[model samples]
Target: MTSQARRKKVAWGITGAGHYLTESFDLFVQFKDTFGVEVSITTFVSRAAEEVARVYGLFHYLQTISPGDYMEEVILESAQGWSYPKTGRFSRGNYDALFISPTTSNTVAKIAYGIADSLITNAVAHAIKGGIPVFLVPVDIEGRIESPVPYFINRDICVGCERCQEACPHDAINEQIDYLKCTGCGLCKDICDYNAIQGGQVMLVVRDIDKQNVKRLRKMERITVLDDPSQLERALRNVLTEEAG
Candidate 1:
């Protein structure tokens, strides 16, 4: 009888940025079955990321991906206290590597400056200290980017019926979309008798400081900066290949 190879475990961190959230999640789902080798992903979501995931309708999706354990499979910053004890897994040699995809400019700055305040940031620090390779895809690496917005309302189409507002579970709708409160459940859009609510992509110009931060991250030790989220699969494959060699 032949024995099956042990699955490679990876730590994936998520931030508040919505640019590549969907794409990153899609890639995450494929990690378990698509990779040549068996791969197990443990997702670590920042507090703001939890909100963004909810707004994007991906919070539940993440839960579905890894339902085995709470902190073991899906670690949320909200549940972790000031110490972020779970990050110790990296120093204990638990994860093969760390991947922070669709990272926000704020997170990039924090990591570049060696700030370990948040759960994801602390994980990066431990991953580096433990000699584990870290890969990141900064959303603002380029000068400009077309990012997806979770929801929007066309006032012209809206009749001020307040039906959408009443239907909103998160109370994200009033006169306009209060992004901070919205979880992108799309319930308001679905309940609206008129077609006022909608969602689409938008173009954003990356600040010069953010671009510089990405440059700084590239020069950091044990960190690989990817051009875009699409390159994640290839970069990870190369890392695993090098490890096997």
Candidate 2:
């Protein structure tokens, strides 16, 4: 491994929203494989992100994907005797940028309103204060987006089996699913051997405040709002290519 001086550092914060979680994970692998030698990337997961990943059966996968680091609202101050010292990388100029992909409306609103209560929020706050670049992909920017998720279950095929319930880390299902808690990770669908979980879609309604926050996000010089997951790859590729050039 090269020394810190030689590699560009990047911090990636994953939120609770599952709109593009799988797609974002694929992109992470692509980024690492393509730029492993040139960049040092650290991943931070929110508490909600951990729950959603478990629901998607990605709990183990997340750990194996990278050298892992996570932050929750409860554990604010760490050994550094400061809350969110990880963002210190930005202030110290150790990191080139921060990327928050698939940012939930909650996260986007908090960042736009200067709410730095959560780990991810605090990191973004510190990063922007430090003049570091922040690239974010908001899930609710389109106002109404078609999210392909497991929206239904074929009860006849379920057979009263509790495997799907057991597989759900968020306790979002019993005989029926609890929509409020479900992050649409599809882990229940993945674990059901009887094919009871049918594939479906849901139309997410974006809030007016979220739209306003997007507007606020647009005005920030340090923040770049990516239209979607694919655009993130192109954006990073372009920047890295320019740096190389």
What are the root-mean-square deviations of the candidates from the true structure over C-alphas? 2.5, 5.0
lDDT of 1 by residue, 59-134 (tens): 8877655655533388889998999999999898787889998899999999999999999889999999998889
- lDDT per residue (tens digit) for residues 191-241 in model 2: 988889876568888888888998999997789999899988987665554
List ranges where model 1 is wrong by over 4 Å. 1-4, 35-37, 70-72, 169-171, 178-181, 239-245
TM-score of each: 0.90, 0.77
Highest lDDT model number: 1
Q: In candidate 2, which residue pairs get closer than 3 Å at backbone N, Cα or C atoms, i.e. clash?
A: none
Q: Ten residues in a row with the worst lDDT in model 2?
A: 71-80
lDDT of each: 0.84, 0.73
